[model samples]
Target: MNEPAQHMDVGAYALGVLDAAEAARFEEHLADCSRCAAELDSALGLTPLLADLKESAPDPGVLIARPRPALLDGLLARVVTVRRAQRTRRLCLAAAAGVLIVAGPLAGSSFTSQNAPSHSTVSAAKAMYEEGEKIGAVDPTTKVDASVSLQEKPWGTHVALKLANVRGPLTCDLVAVGRNGERQTVTTWAVPAAGYGLQGAGADKWSKEPLYTHGGAALNRNDIDRFEVRTLDGKLLDTIKV
Candidate 1:
């Protein structure tokens, strides 16, 4: 990479904003380019201690009074106004909830016994399962063994799972439940020839082993209490609790 390009990339690396593909590409370059890597490391080390002079205030002045430009004053006023509006909205929502709680008994004497089940709720669940099935195909082995492994990294957590002995032909629809009781169904393409795959919450695609995480946005970092791998036939393969 050219010097300017290398210079621009270092900032992204320091902030941990570089994507997986970009990080891998830059690391490859760093391995071959010692001079660039040293410069990047030095810059990264200094970034945290650096101060923004513009944001710093001048020494205390008597009366703390100064003339500010009209545009700057207007901008500051607008920002404060927006903040107050947001606070008001939140207060309104809270007050409405309090009113509901206080008026609940007055609204209906038998409200407590008014709990009812709706078929629509069941239909919605059925639809979701069907959608999961369509997207997540089960592997054929029918018998499954599930295991989860977690590792902490600088940016977030990474997890790997082993789903063993899944029969062939249906390696597709396997879904694993994480410790949070949330289900992650596997799609056909996520499985490789290997017996393990990496899955996280909100993962758009499943891949074999070493699930990539960005501060748990892709998965629930807090809920990673265990791993449960299951077969397509809805049989329990195995589980490893955190």
Candidate 2:
């Protein structure tokens, strides 16, 4: 991407919406551009507020109209081109307001409304870990833990993931990568503030539980290589080799 195009991605980066490749390129640009770096820092401070605001948001499934990535990105880019800080802040607020505008009639939907569940709960993840064929590892630095179970199917592979020791207000995805250098998104989920798979005092019931999530890929078991758990912004949390 050109310098200007790279500058536009600040909002997406802040929102953790950029794919792996895009974020890497942007980080390269960020190392040199003090202006972009400053904007990024300012924008990032608002991310948790965005996530917090969405906690009770109405189901996205019901929205007939949603702002396109292009629209949001373009609006944010416009902010960057503005010479004055005052205009930058104003444009930033307008872009944010545009987002909340689309989250309309905003409140009161259960987590189930998101259509995300393959197993019962943390127990299912544990059962898969303890009782069956599985592979996994713990990241030495992040302390994020993950295990995967794979089953061959006529179409491809069925994957089960049990994730632990991760805290959030973060959205993450399970990715399957092929030996041939192809990647598939197996599944995705949001982690609440209470987190999963941690043992601690003063923790809520949600805090102590692990996550059991399932997804599928077109790659057969023999054709697959590894599974990675990552935040939406492309930060690798853990990798389980098959």
Candidate 3:
């Protein structure tokens, strides 16, 4: 679907009304479309206040209709721009090959997703943000920004990440490039404000434990030489070329 159609559901997203698939889509879209992200941030923040305004407004006999500038067209344009950038990146990456590593900042604002998730779905952001210091936290380095928490079960590692967004969105993709140059797709979406649960090849679920809020987590010293975070369509956001 086109970007505008994809984001027509922004209202539902901000209100926490969409289902899993829908919510993920909007989160990814918001990350790329800064305009929508900014606009939604304003609108969602005002919604509660709007309810208060309704409660305190003048009686029907003295009604006042506020004049606000229309933003639909502008919002659409921005979404298109973001989509084009994503498309360009995807096309470029399609021909490239390498292993994939991912990393980001964790010290800044204590992990928080710009958009909140409902009670049903796990809050990936909060979990990753707090996982470290609680248990299985990774030690951070000077150049590195975030930490990853891992738990061993019957499968591989149960992974939760806490990273920083010093600049724009942390929205990115994961691709596992093998020795033979075969790229195994991971996944990506709008990062939750707090943390997220990763159900990969091994660990297929998140735990029910509370996350750590204080210091205890450390960063790993390994240089993620092949790690990268890219947009949905494949635009490179950050790269660790070792």
lDDT of 2 at 33: 96
- Candidate 1 lDDT at 201 equals 50
Q: TM-scores, in order shown?
A: 0.24, 0.48, 0.26
Error of 3 at 126 (Å): 3.7
Off by over 4 Å in 3: 1-125, 128-146, 169-171, 176-182, 191-227, 239-242
- lDDT string, candidate 1, 136-221, tens digits: 22334443444334444465444433343433333333333556667654322123333334344533222322211111213454
Candidate lDDT scores, in order, read: 0.43, 0.73, 0.42
By TM-score, the best candidate is 2
- lDDT value, candidate 1, whole model: 0.43
RMSD after CA superposition, every candidate: 21.0, 18.7, 20.2
Candidate 2 lDDT trough over 10 residues, lowest sum: 102-111
**Residue 85 in model 1: shift from native, Å?**
57
How high is the lDDT of residue 215 in model 1? 11
